[model samples]
Target: MKALVIDDSRVMRKIVGGILVDAGFEVVEAENGQDALDRMAEHDDIGLCCIDWNMPIMTGFEFVVEVRKHAEWRDVTLMMVTTEGEQDQIVRALAAGAHEYVIKPFTPEVILDKLQFLGLVEIEETV
Candidate 1:
């Protein structure tokens, strides 16, 4: 599956994008929410989005709300990958439309675990 990694920080994008690519996803990246929306318009194969909460032009929360409005994007799963770790923020994101939330400074395993919850991947047992 294709995944969009949206973040204002180039380094964060690289980190998240690398994780998804390692998980077998074709990765496309955008610096912010608006850029991501534009990329999505061009790529119909984007099944997942890893979004950062704070962005210029449009925030990740706004992106979630806006994407949920489009019937064409109904099957796309949104996951917020941000430094905002407050419980209320987590609840708000999920209530808005995010399928999963991962706080920043996360290990790759944390992200893969969330992907499993979203049914995007299955991590094999390691002995």
Candidate 2:
């Protein structure tokens, strides 16, 4: 699967993209919501998106809302990977169409676990 990682911070985008790349996904990076939308247009095979809430051009929440408006993008799973850890913020993001929420400072394992839960990725059984 291909995953788009959207964040204004270059370090954050690289961090999230690296995590997805490690999880067997082709990764793409976008600086903000508008950039993410542009990336989506450029890549039709994007199956997942990792979004950061606060950005310059467009917010991740706004992106989620905008994506939800497009029926064609329904198959794409949206996950908010941001530092907005407030309970209300999580609820709002979910209400806006985010499939999963991951507060920033998260470990790779946490991301993998969320992806597994969303059925976007599978885990192997240990003998």
- Measured by TM-score, the strongest candidate is 1
lDDT of 2 by residue, 1-127 (tens): 8999999999998888888888899999999999999899899999999999999989999999998998889999999998899999999999889999999799988899899889888875546
Winning model by lDDT:
1
Cα lDDT of model 1 by residue, 3-121, tens digit: 99999999999999999999999999998889988999999999999999999999999999989999999999999999999999999999998989999889999999899877899
Ten-residue region with minimum lDDT total, candidate 2: 118-127
What's the distance in Å from true for residue 119, model 2? 1.1
The per-prediction CA RMSD against the true structure, in angstroms, equals 0.9, 1.2
lDDT of 2: 0.92
